[model samples]
Target: MASNQASNNTQQESKFTLSMNHDMEQQQICLDHQQVEEKEFDYSKRSQWLRAAVLGANDGLVSTASLMMGIGAVKKDIKVMILTGFAGLVAGACSMAIGEFVSVYSQLDIEVAQMKRDNKRSNKIKGNNEDEKNVLPNPAQAAAASALAFSVGAIVPLLAASFIRDYKVRIGAVVAAVTIALMVFGWLGAVLGKAPAIKSSARVLFGGWLAMAITYGLTKLIGSSGL
Candidate 1:
């Protein structure tokens, strides 16, 4: 009987040990799941920085190329063309950085304000206990998007300048490239923003074409006026 009791005791101890091990395994699984969930949603700072850098480079390329091309169309010497391109590169980059910051800040401000207004409005309609949470964009995501957009917009022209030999060709290429990039970028932005891509693309293209027409018309005027 004592032997039988000892055997039962050993069996109970084994079962307890197994139960504890099972609980620990379950806890480990939960921890792993939580870690994955965090990773899936997290947008790293490096990603935003990289995006901003690319955008800046693209903008520098496109803007400098367009400016150089336009000036070259006026038959400016290489020295003058190079000077103008350099100036454009600096100015465009600064503009891109400032523009990105302002645009992002404004967007965020408006979003927050709108959310507050919405909450107030909802409260009036459905009472304070309706559990209406304000859904705002992830700050990191917004920063990444804005930085990437502006940097790319600026860098494209700068890179194009390296390939363009003549000022006029550079300008024309810059204009064409910028227009195309704007449309593509606009469409992408719209899609990301949950807007209709076709409408966004059309709007972006129209604006780009309009600007090009004006620039071209001005170039003609400069040529005709012998300026």
Candidate 2:
């Protein structure tokens, strides 16, 4: 009977050890699964339009606001301010679209030309297939993106200062609206582009404020000079 009890104890201990090993394996598998689920972020995909989008919006906000502030400072007429703002918005949007299209198309053309040259040389040697399959930028897509972003951003100040009748109030409204919108744009750009948020926001905000101030100051000076 004593020997039988000892044998039973040995079997129980063996069973416990096996169970513990099984549980440990399961825990390790769970950890591996969790690690697989957490993936590193890839920024290459976002980089394509991230730059154009940020630039488009920044240009729209700054250009439109500066134009409005410059004109509004010298002349208090709402019509003049609105008309100038509208003109800037339209012209700026078109310019951005055209600029993006031309710029991207030119770059793509150059790259294609270079690739063709490379392919010719490569074919003369042993031939390379990698360059042929390289992805190039789409000019239409870039133009559309820039135009849309610029238009959206440009409208903020126009809409903000449109209703105000007071000259000073309208200018203030434009400045306030532009500064706030620029900060938001910067933050959005940073978040989407995976950059530092505060730095981006502050940089955009400062640029916009400086633009308005300079525009206002220059226009005021010119107005004071009576020419």
The Cα local distance difference test for each model comes to: 0.63, 0.87
Candidate 2 wrongly placed segments (more than 4 Å): 1-41, 121-134
lDDT of 1 by residue, 1-227 (tens): 99999999999999999999999999999999999877654535344444455445445544555565566666557667667777776666556656766776787788767767877776554543243334443455554455445555656655555576776676666677777777776676565455688887787667556654665567767987976
Listed per model in order, the count of residue pairs whose N, CA or C atoms clash below 3 Å is: 26, 0
lDDT of 2: 0.87
Cα lDDT tens digits, model 2, 59-94, are: 988999999889987888999999999999999999
**Candidate 1: where is the Cα deviation over 4 Å?**
44-50, 69-76, 111-227
TM-score of 1: 0.48
Model 1 deviation from the true structure expressed as Cα RMSD, one decimal place: 9.6
